[model samples]
Target: MSVLKGKKILLGISGGIAAYKTASLVRLFIKSGAEVKVVMTPASKDFITPLTLSTLSKNPVFSDFYQEEDENPIWNNHVDLALWADLFIIAPATANTLSKMANGNCDNLLLAVYLSAKCPVYFAPAMDLDMYKHPTTIANFHKLQLFGNQMIPAEKGELASGLSGEGRMAEPETILDFLEKDWQDKLPLKGKKILITAGPTYEAIDPVRFIGNHSSGKMGYAIANKAFEWGAQVILISGPTHLQVNYPEIEVHRVTTASEMLESCKDNFESVDIIIAAAAVADYKPKVVSEQKIKKSDLEIDIVLEKTTDILAYMGAHKKKQFLVGFALETENEFQNALQKIEKKNLDLIVLNSLNDTGSGFGTSTNKVTLITKSFEKEERPLQSKEAVAEDILNKIIQNYEV
Candidate 1:
């Protein structure tokens, strides 16, 4: 997989019986299009020598900066090594190494690099059942998590010492898959959660008829997918759309009417970090929806209508700390109408769609949008695929957060 193409991985080998597996892991990473650098501890060399790993990785392995006695080895620079790694992974980590890492003890080249790494760091611990279950080991694991380090839990299987238990280093194949998945899952919005509303909400006129827009929910689904790829946990509440969410990162709640969509959104509002109100909900609903289909109607018929709940405005009043975004589709006074919604609903940003521009509105794969901020500044762009527009909108949200 080119997923790890041009990626640099630092494979740290600590003292463990599982150190013998490093050769296979190194080859796997290389096959997956990654540059592998092996860093072994002195004790680790007893189980598997650096020569075995160096041949597989096609790079010299280094354990320390000090020169050897009688036959001196060249000193390796820790700073250069630490800066070269895109991800530092310590597989077959021993309990002793875990304690040292947790305590910030940088006595070795590997430990020093671990302390200095600014990139993502991961570890796979391996030991006997007793050590893995120890209270101290559990505490150390938590300490690493607090520092934002990722841990690959060891598998339960036959150990080298003839004990079948929960401390075997995860298999080379499993670890390789984990590395690839972690490398590809972008986390720009990590630790942030969001809720979104999409599609056209129907207002029932009779058993067989309703009032709704031509909204395809394409733009909204694109936004949700992009947000999820950026690492946000998304809850999508949609109304009367045939769309199927293609990502596991999003939780979809399908509804039929404006009221149902609003209720679902309200239920998830507090837990969400941001809210995108993109659904085209009817402003008015027939006061009395006939139980039966209206058949053989008169030449001219009038249906009494009542105001539907304004989703965004209702949110503005009940909002605590959630960031809100809205959309305005208008045939005339587009910018003005969008700006008014931005101010009235307390939205951080509003996207304006003009009906006057052909191929730029509902039921189309393309959209030309004007992003109007709460500050009254406008940025307009030409029509593009809904996915590209979603990317632009996500980037704008990132910029807004930075500002």
Candidate 2:
């Protein structure tokens, strides 16, 4: 998936022939799963109608600070618009707008929001060859960069003036690709490979029955998504579950039994830089399997059970240079038990979740976890969404892992 997925993008449109291209830009942002809000200079509306942008973006386009409603003008707060965005971009950045931006001018609503925005700002300059080559324009670009604004360098293409040079706005597709690469390159986890196991392994007893836990695979999926967002190449070994990975970049191996999960992990473990053992693999499985469904001839029947292969312990025994992490869900002696597992499994870290804590354990969306290090250090986190807990877990690893 594009790195822009789920991002809040504030697109700024300025007065230029390239202003019409903002429509395509907005469409591309929406197609990539980003939420877009457009802010257009008053003069920009002359080139592209607000109705067109509004229909494409599914959000009202803002040009003026207020709308005249017969003396009851509705106000649009620039600060709110600024704060709502995760990032802002100005396309078709005319010379007039660039100078005003560099000089702290707030002549229009777009400039006002730009002045108040705290998120990263990017601009794509569009003008004729002479204007682009002007010394003042070049100085403005340097000044904007000095102020921490990124410039999406203009492309060389046909202009409205029937002249072609390095002064055309980047095509919508190019703009999208540029943003994705820029965001991915700056992430801390870029170039790292991660392996994560999730869900509860099911041990089939008969044709229709199996033993499994209440694991929903929510926590592991969250971590995998976060890892991908941090630019890591992720491989997920998941037991049978209804959950789906959000990004297509994740290499997923689906397994139903503990033995299958173990084999899958073994196949990918040597290639990963880090391993997170999140799957609740069944400790025991039925020794004998019936090819057909067993009839209810006996009210109570004895079925022989045997221990499943311990995937984590195997990884520990074969460990070379990989950072291994484990999870322990305990009903008692949570801290002590987690620490012991850390040593036994040779894990670099362990996440401890207790059933005693409310809103945690099993299939719940929220988790209250204590992170235990190899040295027995404890960091407690309050109950929060699984996504937030996943963020914390990865943050701990990223802080200590070299990659």
lDDT of 1 by residue, 106-207 (tens): 888889888888888999999999899999999999999899889999999998788898999998998888877786666577777888888999888887
Error of 1 at 82 (Å): 25
Q: Count residue pairs with overlapping backbones in model 1.
A: 0
The best candidate in terms of lDDT: 2
Q: What local lDDT does model 2 show for residue 25?
A: 95
Model 1: lDDT of residue 300: 84
- Candidate 2: Cα lDDT at 92: 86
lDDT of 2 by residue, 1-403 (tens): 7789899999999999999999999999999999999999999999999999999999999999998654888889999999999899999899999999999989999999999999999999999999999999999999999999999999998988999888999999999998988888888788889999999999999989998899999999999999998889999999989999988889999999999999999899899999999999999999998899999885888899999999999999898889999999999988888888999999998999999999999899999999988878889999999999999999999876754
TM-score of each: 0.59, 0.90
